[model samples]
Target: MSEIPPFEIIRASRRSISIQISKTYGLVVRAPFSVPEDIIHAFVDRKSDWIMKHLARHTEQRERKNNTLYYLGHIYPFEYNLLQKETVTHSGGMFTFSGKVKDSGMEQAALTRWYRKQAQIYLSERVYHFSWKHELKHRKIRITSAVTRWGSCNGHNDLNFPWRLLMAPKEIIDYVVVHELSHTVHKNHSKYFWNLVESIIPDWKAHRRYLKEEGWRYALPKF
Candidate 1:
């Protein structure tokens, strides 16, 4: 039998035991401080397969992030300059950051800020465009840092979209925008809601597939 991989345990004041694997920490098992060591070990044993799968995924994502220099649906080389003031510039298929980028964390932070700014401008514009084209009215639009979902619509008619969507192609971004705007009329994913989306974007299914299959490539490392 193969040896089980070792994992870190974090005992805290919590209700239940849970596991998390990320680039920063390979495998972390969190449990209530009162839980017995043997019970924790048993829980870990039961979840070992899931932990290994996520650990492998984390490793692969880290490797891919290391190889990627450009992001946001654009293939541009990222340039860094330590002598100049701390600012980011994009021009001529290049993104240049002039400032003290002390480490990978700082670099990721700078990129995240830039992505948010771009999302504010680009996503807002797209949302407005779609709303006007479809004669749809929405209370407001907000940018978010959600990891799992691309976009969401609340009962208040407020739409929230992840800044990461800027990393996808424009078509995919449009589909997400339309999907949320449709919620202003129909809150659920009923057949009428899908038909409404198809009316505006006939090929939304292809765009959705692209996001599902290729969106991970654009994921930035979590700081």
Candidate 2:
């Protein structure tokens, strides 16, 4: 708390200066247009303890996120290896990437390709299992890289799901499958949709809440 950490300043038409912490950007200072540079520096110095506390928190979260990978709703330690032969492998309670990727772009592309293939194989089987159990019919199963959507059923009856769903637990995945499959029967999220979803997954709301709260953690790492 003795010295202020590095931060970027953005002066705007405002009355006060505020500090914001980011894992990627470190710290940011938003100040009023009339606030002098020295005044902003003094204010940041005065709040050094608080700023340092948040920075420490961000650091811990960043490290934890970097070290862990979510698969089938479980957190597994992850590693990258440039000298190994296999592209990727899940063994000994770890998910390791052994691709000879030279950069992060190549690394991301390789990992995402693996994630998409896993999604296609796993989700297709689950969708079919549920559809067959309930006597539902679907045209096709598509694994997508959708950011904002988890699963959707269109007029063509093709069930679309994001590869990210593979990061959630199996029950949660099943809930999404039932939810979208129900959409095949009920186009809108009306009373009938909820009723049907409840009929299939009695705790569908809990799973949905889990996704709304923690689903953001399920994504490619930023290193």
Candidate 2: global Cα-lDDT?
A: 0.85
TM-scores for all candidates: the values are 0.70, 0.77
Residue range 1-223, candidate 1, lDDT tens digits: 3235787899899999998875666778899999998999888888777666666676766665533443557656566778546776787777776776546767777777888898889989998999998998998788889989999999999999988888887888899999999999999999999999999999988988888766776677533
Q: Compared with the true structure, what per-residue lDDT tens digits does model 2 show for residues 80-189?
A: 88774657677899988776545667667777888899999999999889899987788889989899989999999999999889988999999999999999899999
Superposed on all Cα atoms, the candidates' RMSDs to the truth, in angstroms, are 5.6, 5.1
Model 2: residue 173 alpha-carbon error in angstroms: 0.6
Please provide the root mean square deviation of candidate 1 (C-alpha atoms, Å): 5.6
Note the residue pairs that clash in candidate 1. none
Query: Which candidate number would show the highest lDDT if scored against the true structure?
Result: 2
